[model samples]
Target: MKIFEIVFSPTGGTEKVSGYIADALEGEPVAVDLTDCGLGFRTVAMTKEDVAVIAVPSYGGRVPAVAVERLGMVRGNGARAVLVCAYGNRAYEDTLVELEDAAKGAGFRVIAAVSAIAEHSVVRQFAADRPDAQDAVQLAGFARKIQQKISEGDASEPAIPGNRPYKKAGGTGMVPKATKECTDCGACATACPVGAIDKDDPRRVDKKACISCMRCVAVCPHAARAVNPIMLSAATKMLSKACVDRKECELFI
Candidate 1:
């Protein structure tokens, strides 16, 4: 059976956690990027014999709306799935349950689940440099357990955390703005998962379209894009208490 690594990582943190797990699990996996809005996920069909690692970052204790939309279009065809929710050291809350529901609705069997820690996509200081060496070891260990389950032909669904009627999704207002150094390079626009940046100008950002994922700021080669410092500082201070401690990875199977 083939392995699928379906991921929605706009700022690379979620991808890193997912990669660590996939690396420890069987063979090389076929990659499926949910962040690419241009991809037609409806055509991504898999056989019942296949296994899939569906990973998405927890955005405000919930899954990104766009990731859910794209994942809905894909045909899982009864493939066994490992659900992973990578969070920024805070609680994932309803993220994994929501993701499990979405994956089941798309025809996947929920065989395993993981709650992992990663660096925050927006507030850089909170959980910074996460999915680090320690995280890698934890995730690899989780993957091995999942492999053992698969080897035993156990398809039991794990008890994932979160409530049904998930908590409301509050929007993050930390939109990044381009600085004077911007050369209209369009790199941010091209790399933006939501197409929130204007390709022609690269300076104009569609705030409504932006998911506050900080992808533009990370992608800007000239370091010309950034959120308001005051806003970032306030957010950092607000979340400091919750993110101060080092969190550990959790696996359910």
Candidate 2:
């Protein structure tokens, strides 16, 4: 059976967690980047014999809108799917359930689920350097358990947590802008998943289109793109209480 690693990681944190699990499960799984704007999701087709490790970052306690949209386009074709939601220390309220629903809709059979921790995409201090050594060991163990379940032909659907009607998505009005260090190299524009940055003028960003994914900020070679300091500080303060305590990875099978 083929194994596919399907992921949407804007700042690389989610990718790191997903990669560990995928590696432990399969030697060289096919990677399907949900962040690649050039990819045609509709063209991605899988069979019942294939397995998919679908991973996404939890954005505001739920699945990111872009990820949901992109995932919808692919046909799972009855593949067994393992859903993973990587979050910064805060709770992943509806992400796993929503992802399960999405994968089921795409013709995948939900077999397992995981809630993992990663460095905060915006508030870097929260869960910083997560999916660390400890996380790696935990995720690897989880992957082995999932492999066992698949081998045993367990068809029981995992009971993932979350409500049928997901909570209203919270908006982070925080948007990044170009700084003096910006070299107008257009790297951010090229890397932006949503085309929020103007290709011709890298400095010009469409706030309405921007999901505040921070791809631009993370990809900027000159450290030029950043959210307003005041806004970042306020956000950091708001999240501090919820993000302070160390959280561990939880697996459902």
TM-scores for all predictions = 0.97, 0.98
lDDT of 2 by residue, 1-253 (tens): 7889999998999999988778877534799999888899999999888889999999888899999999999999999999999999999999999999999999999999999999999989899899899999999999999988888888688889898799899875678999999999999998988888999999898988899898899999999999999989998999989988999998999
Any residue pairs clashing in model 1, and if so which?
none
For each candidate, how many residue pairs have backbone atoms clashing (under 3 Å)?
A: 0, 0
User: Residue by residue across 13-103, what tens digits does model 1's lDDT show?
Assistant: 9888888877777755799999887898989998888899999999989999999999999999999999989999988999999999999
lDDT of 1: 0.90
Report how far residue 206 has shifted in candidate 2, in Å. 0.9
How many pairs of residues in model 2 come into backbone collision?
0
What are the runs in model 1 whose C-alpha is more than 4 Å off? none
Clashes in candidate 1: how many? 0
